[model samples]
Target: MYKNKYEPALDIYRRTLDNQLKLIHGDHRDIAASLSGISWALGYIGHTEEALEYSMQSLAIQQRCTPSYHPMLAHTLRAI
Candidate 1:
């Protein structure tokens, strides 16, 4: 939803993301992916503090779920 109109999409995205996250178990990859998407949308809309926070969360999850040298870890780090 970050494609067409950024701010509005983020508002919509935020409203649903948390509830979805609650249904996810542990530190799943899908949780990290959702966090990354939210972070990207927040960053794109100039909410840098929130963006950074979510990105950091994503990074932490990726770190725990993947190997140190994993490609996804590198990607999540770059995202932050």
Candidate 2:
């Protein structure tokens, strides 16, 4: 279930973000996704403001990718 993903996904996002500066940079796509994931994690951990921030970031990317209301973007919004 998605709820279950909250933990591990958050862990991975955190790890990636932590090592991001040293490991890689220049692409906001993955970073945006990571931030969004972290936002969701923060939301799951009870940080709504942060979660909304991440969700909006992801939403921006999703809109650029889809440019319309696709199933994926819909789901992402629903998640928020």
Task: Pick the lDDT winner.
Answer: 1
Top of the candidates by TM-score: 1
- Taking the tens digit of each residue's C-alpha lDDT, what string does model 2 give over 1-80? 56556778788888987786456555445565676678878887787987887788777877776646567577677877
Tens digit per residue, CA lDDT, model 1, 1-80: 33568777666667656866778768877777778888878888788999999889889988889889988778878877
| Superposition error at 50 for model 2 (Å) | 0.6
TM-score of each: 0.77, 0.60
Candidate 1 TM-score versus the reference: 0.77
lDDT of each: 0.80, 0.73
Q: How many residue pairs clash in each candidate?
A: 0, 0
Candidate 2: minimum summed lDDT over ten consecutive residues — where? 21-30
Give candidate 2 misplaced runs (Cα > 4 Å): 1-9, 17-32, 67-69
